[model samples]
Target chain A: MVRSYIPAEFIVEVDHEKCRRCKRCLLNCSFGALEFKDRVTPLHEQCVACHRCLTFCPEGAISVEANPLGFKYSHNWSPQLRKNIWKQAETGGVLLTGMGNELPYPIIWDCLVLDACQVTNPSIDPLREPMELKTFLGSKPDFLEFDTGADGTLRLKTKMPPQIAIETPIIFAPMSYGALSFNAHKAMAIAAAEFGTVLETGEGGLHRDLYPYKDHIIVQCASGRFGVHAEYLNAGVGVEIKIGQGAKPGIGGHLPGEKIGEEISKTRMIPRGTDALSPAPHHDIYSIEDLRQLIYAIKEAIDYKPVSVKIAAVHNVAAIASGIVRAGADILYLDGFRGGTGASPTIIRDHVGIPIELALAAVDDRLRQEGIRNQASIIAAGSIRSSADVAKAIALGADAVAIGTGALIAMGCRVCQKCYTGNCAWGIATQRPELTRRLDPEVAAQRLVNLLHAWSSELKEILGSLGVNAIESLRGSRERLRGIGLDALTLDIMGIKPAGR
Target chain B: MKNGRAKINASGIYYRELNRMIREAIAAGEQEIELIGVNGQRYIADGIKQKVMIIIDGVPGNDLSAFMDGPTVIVNANAQDGVGNTMNDGKVIIHGDAGDVIGYGMRGGKVFIKGNVGYRVGIHMKSYKDQVPVIIVGGKAVDFFGEYMAGGILILLGLTCPNNQSIVGNYLGTGMHGGQIFVRGKVEKHQLGAEVGIQEIGPQDHKLIEPLLREYCEDFNLDYNESMSRPFIKLVPVSHRPYGRLYAY
Candidate 1:
């Protein structure tokens, strides 16, 4: 399979005059892209632009310059498209990448404009007032039962539907130990515990070290059913039945055997060097009734633990969400096509599921119209980057939002999209002991906590500007949002009005 | 069943309530319990590590001992689907025939089935450290027996079969990665999955097979030597990771 290779997209050039010849760049590069021939030459073809060697160079002598080699440009045949084709043609393999979808699709979050209060309705001062981000997510009952007390006063029913109360609605989304590392899981768990939120243990099974964070973890029972035992199910605030993920909606996830190293072998309870493949659909659950059966099975196992169903934001997400609500799901998590993954095929990542904004709005409107909005709290996820995006999601009817790529960024991910190679220099997505050891749980956890705190403060500020003291008031309040540079259809589907109306 | 024990009259389709009652009783320090009218109430003894004895009179539902650890569950009648799914450690004794997919992903436990099991039995079962799952089915098994089994022991004794027309069904042990399947009687060449092939029982295998069979015969009230005298073959995965060749770099 000797095929012609394309020149590297970005080439690292070393200034000869200031080279210093310390060889720190060659020593720090995990990809071995830097060659120390005469004075630290670079085999740029292997460089994934991880920014590791460049960032650690003691002497400011190296720079990564984007190659001027441009392909024959066509609207349909861009440089990336040509490069991808050439790479596949050379390797004859399915192209694997990481991080969120990088397609230039319409970002509705940027188009959404948040409304502010004026003259008659003055904005609340968040600093002076109690800007409560406190949220209770669960099924809210329709009517209250009043019983006469001994004092001849009416009292409501003593018991109410179960609610998962958290200070902020941001949950640490499920990222598996095999895909990432134990340190990453610890970081997420530590951050979640500090932030008074939940951290999910993606179907790779909870590491033994994370058992201490049991109260803060959400164990996922996906199709693989790896390392799932009675204690695994019980050791969590909730159980998430992963029906599908957003990156590759219909396809399953395959954490290659190379990634299933020593610690992961014990954590996932599978043999070392065995692929941790999550089947696309659960063989036990073939239909909606089967889904209900498994859901109840988990409920039966955990008793009263909150059970959530995570589905990709597909075309019929509303109808599917209705069925999920009817099936007694306390929470429905919708992941858009832009959702990140450790490894996914290029085609599915680029074109598969729908956007989270439209899906959230549609499901919210459908649930409200069907009068089952209170039955399940909607948590939107995909590419929720900033607190303003979180506010937009809340206004569009998401009770809470989850972040994956944003969390990785907080943990020092440069979005190099080379995570599937198991050579992540940032120590966030790789499982190699050397790379994994580079990530300090304490430091990453503190950074994540700071990011979440900043986002929470920004959320409170946005709520105050909207004249709402609590996040609940802005929930499903589509009138508080206006669409900018959006088509009429998109605006209608999103349940928002055009600007200046 | 025992003194100062708890008993639940599970007559309806309220598995949640039944499980809650079982949990409360266990939490209240009741070790031995009995459920009488257990007809298709799924997840009977799910996700519990308490050292208790649960006795069931009737047919328990699907996923009988799913994720169960440490408890000894005795099903007097037949057991249904998904017995001992991803089980950690426990003992499940079924007095009668069991349904499909028994011991699915069973990590560590002993599932003694007295009758024929259905499709995909012991699928994706794995062993971790010293925790090896052991399943002994007395009767014949249907299609895809032990499909994609990653670890543990699967024994199928074709005791009640009329004739030897491959007591096991088609596509037996398909995609089996790691595990040993012992079946009585001869299986046709086409009946085997791609990743597995049958070989004569060796002396080293006898050590592993003898004790498990002795226990199975003891539980079913059968002659151990007479059962062992019959022709037996062992099914072992050609490789630990069978699909490794397809997608490896």
Candidate 2:
């Protein structure tokens, strides 16, 4: 075999004195980095630094660290650039990556700061008062008409559109059952059910086991239409039409045939070991009118369930969102450039879409300008790290925020960025039976539940400090935000005042 | 009134109300139902998971029988776009010409069109276990026929088209991966998509299509012998995974 130019990214060190000869780390290493004949040997080249072995080690014997002698250091030609160039020179293929963009792009969420009530306006204590975090996702009427009966009871004259209520304005983003394990999916489902939020069944259909939790599930229909039968459409509380993912905009998803096991095959409604390719564009939907047809067709199928449209935050996101709303989508899901994915081209994931903060600000401003802000609720996603980020999104006019990587972190993902390799050591992103069994659904569910509960509490605290009792009051209240280090143009576009102003 | 079949005049009724009325009639134990006027009404038998038969007189609109399961819909007139879209366990019979995107993502259904079909017909039709979708057209078909088809059978019998004219259009079965497309007439090599390969109909292929052709003849009142007189050619995907080698890993 020709000598490979690429060097190993990590170095595995085993302290022989501390080793107890149990070889627990050897068994737990999913990346095939450990081998034992007479003694446990480290194949540092295969190590992904997932920390699974480190965490599972019975004794303090193993330590994996970044290779200090990675490359000849050059400020202009960084190690990453040199590595990528060398990789392409060897493989002549697109560099595939898992998870969100790891680029050092400016995070607007960090640049913007929230406001707190001072002496003039007294802040309320969440402990003593009831703060409403509950929000509904769906289109709302511009005005409500009530009829006063002779008995003095007021009757609602206007018909209300279908809405799915969440206890908190935080939801689990779309993560396919096939991409993750059954245990991971179950954990998210149980957590969403316990938390009274929703989890999306990413284009790869809902599993039969998740049917009982259908009330908190939002079934997605992408270009591929995998496992989307009439029953699947009506199984969830809402249906989402996935147009584009933020990680890889303007491209299709290809779940390789290797990942198509018997169960995934059945769930996706394809033959075993066949590539499930979702075309970039829904062939039938060539225009906005065609999109409207599909939206209405789904509405007809599900009868009264709300339909959401998920789109990557492209340059013209505001216009696209407007069209989506006009095309009868009840909920609009906006995924920013920093969105997570099971697998995507590294180039596209880093360079394709805009930030969620900018997209949310633009779409909300446009919808409000057009007087159709009430036509559909907006859910912003892509690297919403904390409850503070969720509050900031709501203040920027998002009705809710979706968390994907954060949720996976709650379930023990170490952000190894090797999900596509099907060797997720934490068992959160892999489908291998042995690795998947590592994640206990009940335990992972409890962790997710705790994370959401903590975030909810923090949201309430943020709301109380803002002198608002309900999350709705904070929605679209841009005056409550101040741009810290953002330039004048950026602040103007986001419609936020400077920190001192 | 005829043979205990419930009849409804869908004139000037909205699509939603008409569908609701159809459901109500079915719930009321109407075994076979018929509608008199269905002009431009969309979603005729959409998502109706019943084994009952629906007969319509006037032309139905787009997305007819979409996501419909276990219901047989017979249209007396031409059907619009999106027929049998993502359908499962049902049958749709369109008497006249049908529009684009017919049988899209359809699984476990049979759609028989008596006349011609528009572009992108039978796109992404998949099969899972016992559910294999089938779409047969008696007349000519336009471009992108069976594009991205994953599974099931598609037969095009262009018996009504002129001898000089092409039976199928360009870029046939463009991204097809796991299905069979049968054409009754000759097609040029350039007309075929790069992902598909043309093969002479084998004995097994003949055996499989014979029963389907007989059923199509029965539905459209055509001569089975005459439909089979012309030599047939089968188009299958070159590889089950056309884009497998395109990626690095």
Candidate 3:
């Protein structure tokens, strides 16, 4: 048997005078960090800085601070590296984590600056101008056909692909109900519906109550095919085939049988206590041709509704996207390595998959070069942080952008990265009824609406400064962006010139 | 037949036009449809949940009856790949042999194949609550039968094996964690995946198969009692959580 040892990473500083010995922290702490040997003792070793105790404490007498364990830190073997090694050596288990990649990789969205017109081109005032931002996402025909008769009458005969029109370019990414609380999903669904956009019902099955908002919902059919039925397939404006996730590429996920409670059981259409596993690779979809079969199958199911194929942003993402478009996908969603997750193996979340910026640029370039860019719309996901990021994504040729972690932040996620424990004190990611109830769906939905409204306004501000009245004018206009700290390969890949050049 | 098919000659018609005709017919409250000269027309009866019937006189293309609900599809001739793919609450009957990955991820309903099936049949087939999917092939099945099958029933009958064919090919039920697979006659030890173990049919097993066998025989004009008289081998998962040992604490 292996012995256990872990250095403390947080110090709980408490005001004994204010502390009423209530021990609220002890009960609320899901990490088993707080204890009461005598009068509410603080076990700093187990504290993960989730701040559940501090928030729940009535007297507000407790606060946590980082324990500066400044070991002889080598850049190669940093404190994180050493601690991870120690934990693995002792536990003999694969490290599990929640949320997105925390590795301090380059955020290319920040490096590229948005361009504005000053002298030559006149700026349009968003308050006065129309500033059309209505965007329709789906496939488009290569060319339009026209019929001219001898009677001097001309008519256009073309059938456009099915698309969902959103007033704004921001779409809420797929966050499962099991991974996130029902309240969180409700908030997302409500806000998206109110905003005329879609909130993707992650691979989790659609709940019965959420049926009213099906028009604003995008159902996902992953490897597990959980809760998939005729009504579920037809309920959404579009259906997404989740081929892969960005955070943990080539890795399947298992929502433990314990999490399949009464409501989730009904939602996922699984037995009350049964493990739901999304296999790493769909057994039937061994090749691109197989992928085509599945795509056409879904298209046949929903006759006219558009179908999206979601895949991770791996090194071969461009080639994969090309195949998916050829396979008759209406939309292609690329999730970068920094994409959020309910839970994933720590190794794959950090080490696998590529960043979204390079992936988007490469895919756009490849599709354009192949002359099939019009065949499918591209939605870039992963770490879309701010309005600037959205503008830059559009300039990089994305039809739209999907945000998951950002929406969670709007719903009060602290980014403490303990979502896998399902004790999220902020009430965003957890299955426990009491913890989940802490989040108010109505208020959360309002907050999300506010966030999207502010972001939309900010996007208009950027467009106005660029002297453009339509959001479509900004798509694929890489000349409007300039790289600040990006290297030659990245600049070349992103199709952007250096800041000074 | 309570819902007789409204016959439509589909010779030289594009698949999209044929599907359009079907949709229009269904919208007009036609309960049944029959497609003649159906050469490689895909996505027939794809997702109509109403209680309807469709009959195909010729070869149907891939993904026939995909995501279909409450419809009975009968293929008089050979059927291609991905028949009954992800179907929910329906029946797909194929008279001739079918291609790969039949009933992939099917959640409900039944698929009855009167002849042989290609590789990877019943892959990822699952069931939820009272919805149990069942697939029966009259002839032999190739490799990877019931792979990753979380729930549902897959029965392989080797009555039509021309050669002294193996009951099922290699890697059978490779990642299967739930559900039961019954094979007629024999299955070699090497053919079984590590996660699966074979057992002699118990009284309970016999009880489960009896109803299914009776229904299958009646559907395809075979004798149920005679089919059950033959010996059967059942394969069950070694553990509910097949990958339990893979992950660490």
Among all candidates shown, the one with the greatest lDDT:
2
List model 3's recovered fraction of native interface contacts, to 2 decimals: 0.59
Worst 10 residues of 2 chain A by lDDT: A67-76
TM-score leader: 2
Residues B1-249, model 1: lDDT tens digits = 435598889997588888888988898889889999998888888888887999999999888888888899989999988888778888999989888878877889899988878888888788877999999888889998988788899998877775545678998888787889998888888999998978899898999989988987887789997777677899988877665544212
Report the lDDT tens digits of candidate 2 across residue range A1-501. 776677888999888888887989988999899999687899887898899887878887889999888456688998988888888888888888899999999999999999999999989899999999999999999999999999999999999998999999999999887888889999999999999999999999999989999989999999898999999998899999999989998999988888899889989999988889888999879888889988988998898689999999999999999999999899999999999999999999999999999999999999999999999999999999999999999999999999999999999999889988888988888888999999999999999999999999999999999999999999999999999999999998899999999
Model 2 stretches astray by more than 4 angstroms: B1-4
Q: Which scores better on lDDT, 2 or 3?
A: 2
Better of 2 and 3 by TM-score: 2
* Model 1: colliding residue pairs: none
Give the per-residue Cα lDDT of candidate 1 at A72: 75
Error of 1 at A222 (Å): 1.4
lDDT of 2 by residue, B49-124 (tens): 9899999999999999998999999999999999999998889999999999999999888999999999999999
lDDT, candidate 1, A1-501, per-residue tens: 564566787888889898899998886788878887777888878888888887888788888878888677689888887777787776677777787789999999999999999998999988899998988767778767889999999998656877777789788888888888788899999998888888888889999888988878889988888878877888887889898888888877778788877888988888788777666777666778878877877887787677899999999999999999989888898999899998888888988899999999999999999999988888899999999999999999999998888998899888888888888887888887778888999999999999999999988889899999999899889999999999999999998899999
Shift in Å, residue B205, candidate 1: 1.8
Which ten contiguous residues of candidate 3 chain B have the minimum total lDDT?
Answer: B240-249
Candidate 1 docking class: acceptable
